[model samples]
Target chain A: MAAVEIHQFAECITCHAWSPDQSMIAFCPNNTEVHIYKLLADKWEKVHVLYKHDQIISGIDWSVNSNKIVTVSHDRNSYVWSQEASEWVPTLVILRLNRAALCVQWSPKENKFAVGSGAKTVCICYYEQENNWWVSKLIRKKHNSSVTSVAWHPNNVLLATTSTDGKCRVFCTFIKGVDKRDLGEGSSNDLKFGEQIAQLDLSVTWAFGVRWSPSGNTLAYTGHNSMVYFIDDVESSPSAQTLALRDLPLRDILFLSERVVIGVGFDCNPMVFTADETGLWSFVRYLDERKVAPTSSKGSQFSEALGKLYGQSKQSTSNDTVEPSKFRGGAHANCITCIVLLRRSAATTVKRFSTSGLDGKIVIWELDNSIDIQQPGYR
Target chain B: MAEEGFLEVENLEAIITRIEQKSRKIESLLKQSKPVEALKTALEGSPLKTRDERCKSANWIVVHRAMMAIKDVDAMFSSLDPEYYDILMKYLYRGLATGDRPTCDQCLRIHEKLTERAGLGCILRSLADTVNTV
Candidate 1:
């Protein structure tokens, strides 16, 4: 079993993000305020509180290279935060969205970001040096329903989005002035701005989280109906494979490697899925090792026997310190909403990740690949 | 009031007559050892749209007969189209709901093979759909 670390944050965390150096953390406590915590010796100390949005914050992303934080909320606005001296300041972006924004993510180059909204559009926002503010360009008329999540491809040009319309689409977000003429190979350079490259209709229900693999060769997303789809060959013919899970639906997913992915959501346990030598995807195991409650059958039986010998003495059952009623087996007691990669050994392989959810607890999990417990089709 | 009730009864009778006709054709195909064609005919024009219990049960009997008559599970699934997987799952659930020992056993046997052939999405879609209840 992997080593597990737990932290108590708030009543409920809507979303969270880690700093570039992994020293401090920021999260929304299911409210309008965003709290930034600094690690102080053995406990976390509240260092900053960002209060600008009038509604609940939905998504937050801390840029890895430039060390900037971007946040979106249901108030149809987004803010980019930068550190000045000892305080963080917010720069408002004119998203021009009429409805609430659902999710946000920065591009691989940190030059732009995308915000999905209930207005059936994605706002690709970038810094404007002349205006001294961030401006957005709308990709409209492609999504017929509310856009739920957005993920950027590694090439920094192609953006993948999932929506309530039961479709995942890959669109080119290349702007002439902002993007270079020639990206790397397979950068989808020929497509115009906002041109959709592919639309995958594998789910019959609302699709939620979406992530592109490290190599940008495959795309994965989850549906409300407890199904996950992986599509390959995005620029050309897109082929898809669907894996239906028996547990509750997943809200978010992260690609640990090119072959491994960790999915977390309503099941309250992080699930791992891996691909084999033939590239056949299958469910492997859950990261949550449900700890056996202290009240084992043998212990219960002994207590019962002792009670019988003592002629119906009630103290034996009540003497136990651990309340069995509140003892849940898994680490999380509620739905898991977000998962972020905390540490990675290399670009392609992940070493550590953190998951937080409605339970208001953040659980850090380490991946131990040395065991090679490749129990394929074990589900 | 009596006339409207009588018209609904007549509509149900017509639906039952059509179902029985289809059932006869499916039985004939099954006798010829063509279970795939029999299953295909059984799934067409399912009575799930109608709220009448008689029409649904009559159509379900036809579907259950065709499903149980098959001997080779893999051969039938190999030739089956993906479009029919969801409908087959619905009928299988209905068969299991009947609570008969042999019927449930047969339904579970087919359900396992169906899930293996068509991923778990087939079962999820079948269960999630509220419009087409068998």
Candidate 2:
């Protein structure tokens, strides 16, 4: 893009989720307030504010239909917000054991969610048949440490969870009220429970983030020492291979497309990598490495010199080693905690991508093919 | 006596003026590459205690002016030399470990400059680990 315009800047943006339709972004600034901004009239404006959480909001996700939003917070509660009577209201509240809920995600096809928390528990709450809202189906997993992150597969039939114990587990969703006696004799009740589909042992002691690929066949997770591991053939072999990635402590990973992955590293650089079906990987670009002119006086000469240096280097490097100049500055005032990219139906155009950092600033970058990335002044 | 004190003040003013004029002449002489004359005059015409003091005074002015010209943390760091960056990193590491917010700011200033010279990839992950530990 020629220039990235800051649509809305918050002082304490804790978490944000984009609508599946790419028309709105719902954000929780800290834990108590949730704001929804609609992209209309050529700008983003607040459409809803949810003020129900009594503690800091720790996790947020949007439903597949974009009609509902789920949030979990340190208040040990998970809430579902739905559009009702032209306003957003808390349609459901699932109270868990008296422990802080760290993350929540909605199932792709069904109105179900998986909530992970500090209590070493993973609760699967679904919409009740009689009531219009949701109810908790608490599953007390035997995890030694707190669950750090959770994700529901696109099929809505599987859930992936990670913990500080350095293990990634995939669990199959079990239908509610299903009895073990109905299946067969000598069948264990644990089989009636969500089956642990797979588990991966990691070298690092902590798995801070975990995400399933869009195809639901592969998984990617990040942990200590800046390691990002990718598990392919999760369904067939139950074995995972570590994908070679640049050495940086990755904060979060998002599958932008089947082949392209976007990740934010602890070093504050947003990286785009492409992987083939065989698991061979290639680094596409480092978003923060894009050259831009210094906006101030003290480093103007240095910036110019750097730009010239890059230009000279670009000339000497082979075409395969060089990337398009369309990269923009991904600099943040503090450590980047999260990143989300929303693609339009065409997938060629990026509707909006946001990055929030420790400095409490959330920036929305709008991309258009018409804008040239080669302009040195475009930051 | 009061009259004697006034006479001493007048003499001091004259000495200051003379020093100022001589310093300007020395500056011109240095600019013209007359190093011998410039060094001799700077040494003999001024009452300054040592060359180190003169250098310190000059550095203070440079620092004050540089600070004034700077607009942000990035600007402040971009102007610093490599030596300052090294000192800054040491100070920042110490400050961050102590949980001193003021030291964090100071370190951040140095980091901003280093980030300008280098990319965020060079310093961010290490800094994050340090902060997290603190």
Candidate 3:
């Protein structure tokens, strides 16, 4: 089957989350409400609208193992929704922060989720069986700016957080009561929640996105200065490698294999970056580079000019965030805001990925090992 | 819309970098007596006569700078014809809208020179034609 697009509204898709089975899609339509859609007969039908927040919804994540959805908003609220009696019920996670919740993600174990907020904290929220409510413990005082993005290690004990403060820190979120003992390099007795395990200065600008490698040995993040950085596991000290891109700031990133990463943002296309065993990161190629049709140099550059005019004409009708179409070859006409890996196993490579953008598009790219994850390079 | 704003600002930065690089390339090409090649390089990202189409292109700013470079540049004998001022004007207005102080200043410089070289009569004729056609 070809890639399916679920267009909601122009410039309205803030972010989106997909269920483990890829049957359901939940996205914030640039508002307080989270709209859930189900794939029905090769088309998406709006099934449910999750509402509660009085402000714009910033992020949403669906835990594949738990079959639950968590959403954070600018209203300083975070809700974990579970379906009971065929209706989604909201369980309020008590994220008592001074400012808005910016982003959220579930851990690999589905036992907990992390909410990055404007209050300079990442609230690691977990289910308190005793109280029957989700409770949050703070990873406090580490970040000076609002935490923009967060990713959890496969071990479920460590978290990688990126903040607008120009710092990306790896913290050991090993709660004594909640987390079971796991034999790992950083999971020592001295390790505790909020303890900074390793920190890397990504750039002078904000680190907008971060992702842990499948092996949990490396961390990759995109900086607001249009740079992609990687933190590799080097015995006790992690090594930081930065590759500066010539494009706009990449808003998000995802790993296709251990070495290949796809970054998308203002460039309006997914740029592939790769690393070798030497830990040197470099820009490999762009996924979408629209080839101009070969034409005789005789007449009508006017049509090409008119085509450009017609393309730009739509930008003015949307909100302020809608950029003029730049990626002439990419699927998404605007900046891609979110990207998630579609995987069959935790240990192997991700065969597919999905991206949602300001163009109100949901794009899926399926990969073949020989074609997409090819390791050809200067190495 | 926050996402859009973020993309636009970052894109502006990216576009500026690209324009700076290409403008230098054009300048160098002209210095090497390769005006034809310089024009070709200038037209690389933005298609010829496709001024309005490149609003999202990093080449938009570069195209403007390239146009100005050729117009001001003494390429052996002839400068870029005054007929291309409309294309330059398109980006000039859009660049001004960005409120980039240095860029607007550059545009003003180009504008003064454009009026002077094209002469007030041709400028008025084109302006009247534009107004009438619109």
Candidate 4:
């Protein structure tokens, strides 16, 4: 069973981040105030409130290894918070942008982080010990529109940034003092700071989500055209292959393995896709499709609700067609905005993953070993 | 593997049911000769629940065509999803008035930069009107 908890009522949760131990959660309730809550006795206790940003907070990412919370906001500023005694202290980051910041992400190595902004810039921010504050370098030449999301490469030197221009661009964010070595032999960039070498524009619609594969060999992004594309970073000019999807467009995605990925969005469910024997990635099955039967309708005078109340209906029994139910047989009530891969010992399989969304629910779903996704159709 | 575009039996049934329900509303409005209100409900009833930009944009694109089918951009805007008012404005600013992309599919074509952020045109005009009255 998937354990789901409703955090707020009718308010969209813009973004969320969990601590390393998964005991505490930091989320912005589509407001300027950032709420930090801890898990106590199977219930969430509001531990502290970090009220600083003047505008609504856009995104939050908790650094697992560093125990720091970094947030970017519509006010065009970013802050890193660390617990001191009983309160959280906020250190201002010099983003130096003209427009609102959309999202923030920390690198795996925890030495640096990246912020995607509406100013068509991805600010690769790092702590400047000399000044005792974090500062950002601008990557603005290639992107022609607002950058929506940013993901850090596994090596912590590369950054994948997506924008409204239907393109996903990768930049080498190697700061002199932060990165000790040069770019890998397989990387396409020139190992220079803020140089974009791999520019794979899907040529369909904007890419709102981008994730670097765990191995850092491939980059996957969800396009606005209901298409998922993966770019191999090894080629002189990285080539992108679109992952086939017959359903609605995906908003967010995560790499479960080098070959398998989980995409969640308007579908109100998480879908698992895996690369075939020939290395072609294909949709495997919906991990949340627990219902095999149609819902029972209210017999007499019928008026069923619609909107974010139900999933996209597939098919049903009886020739007349039955109405879709509110999150009937699915785990989420509405569009899933984000998915976080939980603690896992294996690279190819995920023991657990959590999803939070517009429905105001954060759900943790555990995977069953019986449904092996490597097989073409696990269902 | 399942066939392309293949939905499960239950899903298909529920989808058909939802379609039938909307069709009934469209039919009743036509019978009452209030196609504008009929179209208004359709546009207002859009799936903002998707929250995904592509899905939300796609839903509005379909509603845009429905408005074009009725040829009443005013009524469509009157009951437009406030969340998508900017999307519709951007669609118009880019002169996608014909409801056809360069690729000719439902794929995205117009640039979001084309929008005139709360300028004299679009809803800002109505907002100005209300402000004057108050």
How far in Å is the alpha carbon of B30 misplaced in model 3? 21
lDDT by residue (A252-347, candidate 4, tens digit) is 998877877889887677888777666677777777643333322421111133221232343334432353233355667778888887775456
- Chain B TM-score of model 3, please? 0.46
DockQ of each: 0.16, 0.03, 0.03, 0.02
Cα shift from native, residue A42, model 1 (Å)? 1.5
The C-alpha stretches of model 3 lying farther than 4 A from their native spots are A1-11, A185-187, A291-329, A345-350, A373-379, B1-134
Q: Could you tell me the TM-score of candidate 2? A: 0.62
Candidate 3 chain B lDDT trough over 10 residues, lowest sum = B125-134
Following a full C-alpha superposition, what root-mean-square deviation does model 4 have from the true structure? 15.2
lDDT of each: 0.84, 0.62, 0.72, 0.68
Q: lDDT per residue, candidate 1, A1-379, as tens digits?
A: 4437888899899999999888888999999989999899978999999999999999999999999999999999999999999999999887999999999999999999999999999999988778787889999978999999999999899999999998899999998778996885654868888999899988777899999999998899999878889888877888889987766789999998888989999878888888887778888887775333422333444445543644333346664424423333577878999999886436542268888899899888887654433543223
Q: What is the TM-score of chain B alone in each candidate?
A: 0.87, 0.31, 0.46, 0.38
Better of 1 and 2 by DockQ: 1
**Model 2 regions more than 4 Å off:** A2-5, A131-133, A177-191, A243-247, A290-331, A347-352, A365-379, B1-134
Best by the DockQ measure: 1
lDDT of 2 by residue, A1-379 (tens): 4225444357667778888787878887775888888878997788888888889898888876756888899998878887788787786576566789988887776467888888888888877766666778766765667788888776566678888777788776766542123323232223445677777776336676788777876788876545567777665576555543334567677776565666675655666656766766556555554434333334556667766766777778767234544343344545667777665567464535777766566666554322322223322
Model 3 per-residue lDDT tens digits across residues A46-152: 89988888999999999898899999999998999998887899988779998999999999999989999999999999888888989899988789999999998
Best-fitting candidate, scored by TM-score: 1
What are the chain A TM-scores of the candidates, in order? 0.88, 0.79, 0.85, 0.85
Ranking by TM-score: 1, 3, 4, 2
Candidate 2 Cα lDDT to native:
0.62
In model 4 chain A, where is the ten-residue run with the lowest total lDDT? A299-308
